[model samples]
Target: MLVLVFGYLFGGAMTVPGGGDYREFLLPGMFAMTMLFGLESTVLAVTADTARGVTDRFRSLPIASSAVLGGRAVADVIDSTLRLVVVLLCGLVVGWRWHDGLGAAAAAVALLLLLRFAFIWVGVYLGLLLKTPESAAMVQILVWPVGFLSNAFVAPETMPAPLALIAEWNPMSATAAAARERFGNPGWGEQSWAAQHAVAMAVGWPVLLSAVFIPLSLRRYRHLSR
Candidate 1:
């Protein structure tokens, strides 16, 4: 939570002229960042347990094998919810408001939670695949570049042509664009397609990612115990 709060504050400070009222732009990105951070930590913890032979002990117990991974995912979701509350409170303190009213705000939060759920499954798959703390730590380094390359801190158009193209297609960019519209931010572009497509892509990616990773993680978990 501190990282996200300070991250938004620092990001807001860097973007002059908009810094005073940039929460509309910064809030969604911070939410995404918080989710990603939580996902990475959950993955790391699970991988560490596997590496330390804790998972072996759990496998020997009479408790259902699914309980191990399921419990971690559930606990991570609860933790993510708490982190989101903190981030939202900080946003309120910094003058963030949802102009599209409670419904839209709730939808935005729901989408964020969905994204976190998707990532949790992805983390589970990765944790089981690598089965080591070192490999999981190495995988986490990719998060920085992925987060930065998206429209988290700047408009995609402001980026160079090639990079802008990549940013536009990024799920984070789509999520942020949808969030900006929900917040009633001005100058969100005249074309409706960008926003429409962004909303679709943002929601779709998480669904697809979850569908793919969750089963894979479950299979890998079963295999590991055999």
Candidate 2:
């Protein structure tokens, strides 16, 4: 919520030729950014369990091995959804209206949940791979760069040409773009192949990430238990 508020304040500060309402333009990105931040909780919880040997205890239990990870994933998604709702309500209080009707808003929420689901798998993989809270803590620093490099806070065109190219292709950029378009934010770049591809990539990424990581993480868990 602080991040979203700060982003609105920062957006309000910028001077541009075709100036737009910063609050309106920024709210969708803030929504996406909030979900991006939620991955930290997943990482922390998983790493903590590993560090305390709670995961090992689960491994030795009579329950199916998948239950341990599956339960965590289910719980994380519920928690993330609640957080998104609270942040959206905060956006509403700050003059961020949803110009796009109910359908678009619903789709936007679905996309956010999809992103969270994908990141859960990432958290699982990281938790299983690192096996120690300190190791995971060191690697988790990359989330900031990944979050900042995309269109979450500013227009990708505002970045240097080389960096702009990379930001343009970033997955979070696609998610932000799609959310902005759905939310009716102004000053978005010209609709190009990138914009068109963003929708597909945004949806496809979570599915692909989950497919690859869930099995890999489960396999790793099984091996560690033996």
Candidate 3:
């Protein structure tokens, strides 16, 4: 609710330091960022289970270790999809619309869900590695920096050179930028490769994250002793 309100109020009051339609540009970015919030659901679930010895009890069972993680993944996807519906309705209430055809809109939805899927593995891995629920909770602070460093609420070029470079290349930026393009919303009028190739990067970021985190998470899950 706070995020949706900030997107509407801030997007309404601020221009992109240029002539771009801030609210329209901001809506898709907010959509992508909102999907990322599912990280907490996965993290907290895993950490609480571990802290309560539920995971240890599951580990002692005869079932495959993969089933535990699979159950969490399935539940998270179902919950995230429901939450996405609410966020989409909120976006519509704020005057955000996709001008593109249904195919493009569907593609945007896939990318957003894929991004959430990839982040789930990341949170799972973190939860398995952390010593306590408190430590796992602290990991959430990393999400704020990760979300803000991207071109979600502002154009990367507007930042200082060092920060701008980081922002332009942030994986979240690709998904948000791709979302704006696919949704036919206003975008930064830049011609850089990152700006021009948002869709590919967005697709690649999730794939890369999943590739790296899946094995790590499963391995950590199997190593319950660690």
Task: Write down the TM-score of every candidate.
Answer: 0.84, 0.89, 0.93
Q: lDDT (0-100) at residue 31 of candidate 1?
A: 75
Best by lDDT: 3
Instruction: Compose the digit string of candidate 2's lDDT tens values, residues 1-226.
Output: 6766675567567532356676676777777777777777777788889889898899888977688899999999999999889988888877777777989878878887888888888888777777777777654486777788887667777789887777777767777777776766654564457766777877987888889989988898888755
- Residues 1-226, model 1: lDDT tens digits: 5645665567455442333345566677777777766767877878988999988888888877668888988988998999888888888776667788888888878777877888888888888878888888776676777788887676767779898778777766677666666656432352335545776877988899888988898788878966
Ranking by lDDT: 3, 2, 1
Q: By TM-score, who's the top model here?
A: 3
Which residue pairs collide, candidate 2? none
Indicate whether candidate 1 or candidate 3 has the larger lDDT.
3
Checking candidate 3 for backbone clashes, the offending pairs are: none
Residue-level lDDT of model 3, residues 1-226, one tens digit each, is 7766876777777676546668788878887887777787688889889989999999999988778888888788888888888888898897778889989988888888888889988889988887477777687698888889989877888889898888888888999999888888888865678878999999999899999998998999898795
True-vs-predicted CA distance for residue 127, candidate 3, Å: 0.7
Report the error of model 3 at residue 43, Å. Answer: 1.0
Error of 1 at 8 (Å): 7.9
**Model 1 quality (TM-score):** 0.84
**All-Cα superposition RMSD per candidate:** 3.3, 2.2, 1.8
